[model samples]
Target chain A: MSLSLNQWTTRRWSVAEAVDGCVRHGLQAVGLWRQNVAEQGLAESVKLVREAGLRVSSLCRGGFLTTGSAESLDDNRRAVDEAAELEAACLVLVVGGLPGVTPGEPLGSFSRDLGGARERVAESLAVLAPYAGERGVKLAIEPLHPMYCADRAVVSTLGQALDIAERLPAEQVGVVVDTFHVWWDPQVFEQIARAGERVFSYQVCDYLHPLPADVLLGRGMMGDGVIDFAPITRAVLAAGYAGDVEVEIFNADVWAADPDEVVATMKERYASVCGF
Target chain B: MSLSLNQWTTRRWSVAEAVDGCVRHGLQAVGLWRQNVAEQGLAESVKLVREAGLRVSSLCRGGFLTTGSAESLDDNRRAVDEAAELEAACLVLVVGGLPGVTPGEPLGSFSRDLGGARERVAESLAVLAPYAGERGVKLAIEPLHPMYCADRAVVSTLGQALDIAERLPAEQVGVVVDTFHVWWDPQVFEQIARAGERVFSYQVCDYLHPLPADVLLGRGMMGDGVIDFAPITRAVLAAGYAGDVEVEIFNADVWAADPDEVVATMKERYASVCGF
Candidate 1:
């Protein structure tokens, strides 16, 4: 009942299918992705989850904010609007990586200014935080694993995310403590304690070794990889976050499996590993 | 002249060949790997570099201390002996990752106790540091990138490495500032300043984007990836680290290229980007 299914764990499932899967599994909450919501039509998507008696725990990202461009800001605002419409707990932010470095191009052909990119994330968050606050929504900044620092999110640790979050209002901006990303950090427990009430969301996944060719899709189910979930879960709980613990995996193999089976396994892993 | 070539950059070259290449490039130093030295025979390796008037900048590794096995300890002791004989600046320690987790096995089947593994590293260092100091061979702990934290090195941050090193005698235990490993850290500059005299070796290479299938072989030559070198180079220099700046790369493509051309490119990049 405390477990939430991040739609990406069963990436192939539609909004209706995912909600149905959650209902069948006795899950009380679901995390929605922007693309899936748009595909199902935002109104219909919101209605589908609401009618199924499922709470929207968090929305799957709205922060590619490193560019600070009008287009990106507009997109983020729209994402915030969508999160508000679904009445999601928070808008998860996968803050964009360094600007102008596209894949398959000459490596680092553009700006390699990581500090500048990080500053831009702060700047954009400042702009979006108030808008979200007015709409009664919280923005959650998810610091990705350091491996993704170059091309994904420049925010690479929970401490760094907290640093950025602390600069803004705690009520408007906070952090997501994703197990797969922050488990390797030596200061993880300390940072989780420091996160306290700013902990808007707690997502779970495992860090698979012999990382696949596409490291992007390398996340494993809870018991399948190197993460020990109980400590992190307890830390988040101790921080006073009595929210849905979302199971968010991005493994290619997981996405190809049966949706129902994936949901079933997720429930079992969450119950066993999360220590709830 | 201050730039040194890490032997693994041209991994195909013999110890003698690497030494010759250093002499040809007007480089004053070379960072040696243990296997390469064993291949050339330790005595001959010492003679070859000595005769070429090349300073052995630092030996490429001596710690797999996470296992805390007697065999691992013995092998590390032998490595220290080699470094002392070679008169290298330090024995670079790529401390082992989590214990009992071999590749191609079940992921979390072994201990997920990162704290325990780290404590083992500290214990191994406590035993080995005195041995290294007596031999006048400094043990340089290289905090690998977080991506490698699971299977390569438990020491994933320069600050963490410093915390470990501060417990031992500064003369015996130190840290390596490898750009490829530590560039993503937010506290890099602050930690570098704190490192001061404890900075044993400075290794340079760029973090390539769209990491190759094998992330281990993903380092790019300076100026080829997403790192702004001048600031870090300046920071290390400001930290009072005047040792040879070793160009240590490990890309499969670089390995397959002409060693002469690679050396030439390394020199040019070092001169231009390193601000020497």
Candidate 2:
């Protein structure tokens, strides 16, 4: 399959099981998350995927630089280490939002310093880039949808991500062009072209509105939502991005389905919608 | 008060009651919605607000041209007529997204043709601009947050909105800069500056994440959420936007509050947070 199954797309599946499933389904790549790797012992997880004849497409995340503190930087370094040890293509960063609030904080307690949060992300990236380069793991900053700007990633556009990525070596720092987060952007195609060879990972998922009860879990499967995969996929290809196209959905209904069935459906949808 | 109370901020109140509430709170202006205008006879609604000494700052809506149908264009023309009859400063256009689906359509059934929808908006605007110009009503295209791009407005940035407005006479077509819909934008200040005299309306509200179940009703009152109002308010003022600053919240809790109390709170928040 031209698509790689991102671990979060099937959150219930174990690392070994996911790799085995990918092998059985003829998917050559898998995008694994940190927590899943920790669950099976990072070393063991790496060996299992490699033994299964699968490539680790990208690590799920390693950024929460909203705080821009030593501890946050250290955690990100460890994430880079993990990505390097697993021989993944890049360590995806969900560069977090404003500082001084925990996840699920009450609406009233939210911070108003978006500019400060964004600056901190740049500072943290500056500190981590050299470390990631040394470890031979590319840092892929993912620009999430603007809806996630308050509580999740402050980076909300591919152009914004490229702005940060351009400050570092292209091979060391890159951007992830996730369709679900960026499909609405008017300048998406132009920005993707600007990304060119610095495009580290190409993630696909569909955007469905009237979002589910929890908006974060509202990503729809490809072909089931409003995004046209062909144009975006073509853009990525034109940008010279030959990376695995990872399907990373976070939906309640998708997670509830049988794991194998979900893989089969994803493969079918990716093939039909992406023309892969 | 420099702040105008948008009709949806206290949605439960009738037109007379809202105007009375504004009068009682010493508010000089109001942002009226079409439904509320329709609730009372259009002429009566105009007479009532004028008698109460309240200026109708802007009409709530008039563009869902994403469908590009004759019916949609005609409806928008009528909205222009309503705004002119009411003597509103401008008619705010939501500029609906994608085609072939009605509002509140199941998320999975969304249309994927965003580029086409946006082109249709430009075409319809070209049609409506002259009509709105003749009526002395400025068509203010409100660029909704990108999250709303699937079902609401496809124009997701001030730059995108201006791109549409600049196609015609600046007096007939302008853009509404709503803080809630645009707080996360990286180029907000630059775009606002570019807007200059074409900024037809300045709307204020705060963005709170962990959105309420009904995301549409998630807008918070000025000081209660994550937005830093001073900078944005300053930017709008600098852009030569001398129009009434409207406080347009859609929170369920705010709606349930006593209309008088809500107006009082809006006045307080606008003064303290927006420095108005």
Candidate 3:
């Protein structure tokens, strides 16, 4: 019912400090990343959030069948296990693209077998969904911005994600509505309606710059980009998702500023722009 | 119908050189950008093409709604005028995005109001379509890669485009299906089926790199990227689009190479990959 700070928003802060900072900022919850938990030690990090009286909204850090890596499948399953251990609502996966790491320089004569990459993602998710669901964690398939389709996530359109979701039982699979990736989709509202109550979590970030190749770190803070938040919020609410609002951003400039000040500004902006 | 080399395929060539190169490579047709046409002098360029005995398959562009700039609107209309002057088959319209110069810098606010842009584009087209149609030129709504929604064209999906096309009598408006834009779309085949008979032109390009900024120049060559051209071609052919197969690529690297070599290779690759 309250806001959650996706520690990604305040990247400079340790996961512990991020949780502490969220507590300080009156964010009722927080979403932890696997690396953040690992860096701060999962137990201590969990304790830190508890001590600060915060909720772990959701745990990202899983999925990405980039190039059909079986090792990636195992790694993602571990992420599912870790998310369960963290007692998060869902494990958000930024499904992978293409096979192999070194698709190498000058995609010179490169074959963007996106269809193959997509098949691998679906296959991996099919493999992992039951595990995550069995552990009482929903798999929140966050369809990324279309710009990330080539390298980050092939799941570009929310409609496309909904199609994927309809493939899985509503109770077993769900989607995380992230404004940054989906705001541009023409069928966004209609898709959101389709996603309906299966909307497990919602994320907000603005497109600060043209989509970057290094998409993970170039995220913009809400209100700083061209995403109309109220419509998205209305759709999420209409879809019957009453989860904590998570401010998940990864902007370098936002992180470079004082973390405390960033939180204050984000809180104020969220209220001003999104009315949290 | 023979394949056309969208001069962009031999960007290194002058207008005359592109014509010479395409003719030398036995490519019977070509698409010319209005800017280059302006540089080459429209009359002289038309004469040169006539002398070369090549089909002026399509004009490279006739839209830039993103700027919302009167200047851009005027310029685009002029582009339409030029397309008409050149006696091109169609004035390819890459509808512009938000009213700004920075194409990649998606405005911090999501403009879900594509309806407005669509209206504006339609308004512009309403003015230009008559003129274009009068000149025996068709308006080809080349739905760009969705990545261009914010900066280039709000008209991303082919379905959306066909919806726009439905607004006019079918003959007045049509689509220029470029494989690179809609290749990854899950609904591409279905949409192509839906786009039947009205397809004015079809292009083929691949996506070697992830869909990111610096896009215009980053397009891959035919058969080089993961495009299922055979199926798409079958769909287009089934749709009754009997036209020149244009090879439109925007790779800076490829363009920086020898124009002669690029054309020869394109012909060979197109023949081998997609066939005639």
True contacts kept of each: 0.70, 0.71, 0.38
Residues A207-234, candidate 3, lDDT per residue (tens digit)? 6556566556656877676666888888
The sequence of per-residue lDDT tens digits that candidate 3 reaches over residues B35-97 is: 788889999999999989888889988787643567767776677678777778887888877
Task: State the TM-score for model 1.
Answer: 0.98
Instruction: State the lDDT of candidate 2 residue by residue for B96-148, as single tens digits.
Output: 97775554668544568888899999999999999999989999999999988
**Residue B72 in candidate 2 has what lDDT?**
96
lDDT of each: 0.91, 0.89, 0.77
Off by over 4 Å in 3: A66-70, A101-113, A210-216, B66-78, B104-113, B210-213, B223-228
lDDT of candidate 2 over A74-191, digit per residue (tens): 9998999999999999999999877755546676445678888998899899999999999999999999999888888999999889998899999899999999999999999999
The residue-by-residue lDDT of candidate 1 on B146-221, one tens digit each, is 8888788999999999999999998999999999998989999999999999999999998888888888887999
Candidate 2 regions off by >4 Å?
A107-110, B107-110
User: What level of docking quality does candidate 2 show?
Assistant: medium
Tell me the deviation in Å of residue A165 in model 2: 1.1
Candidate 2: the clashing residue pairs are: none
Model 1: per-residue Cα lDDT at residue B201 = 95
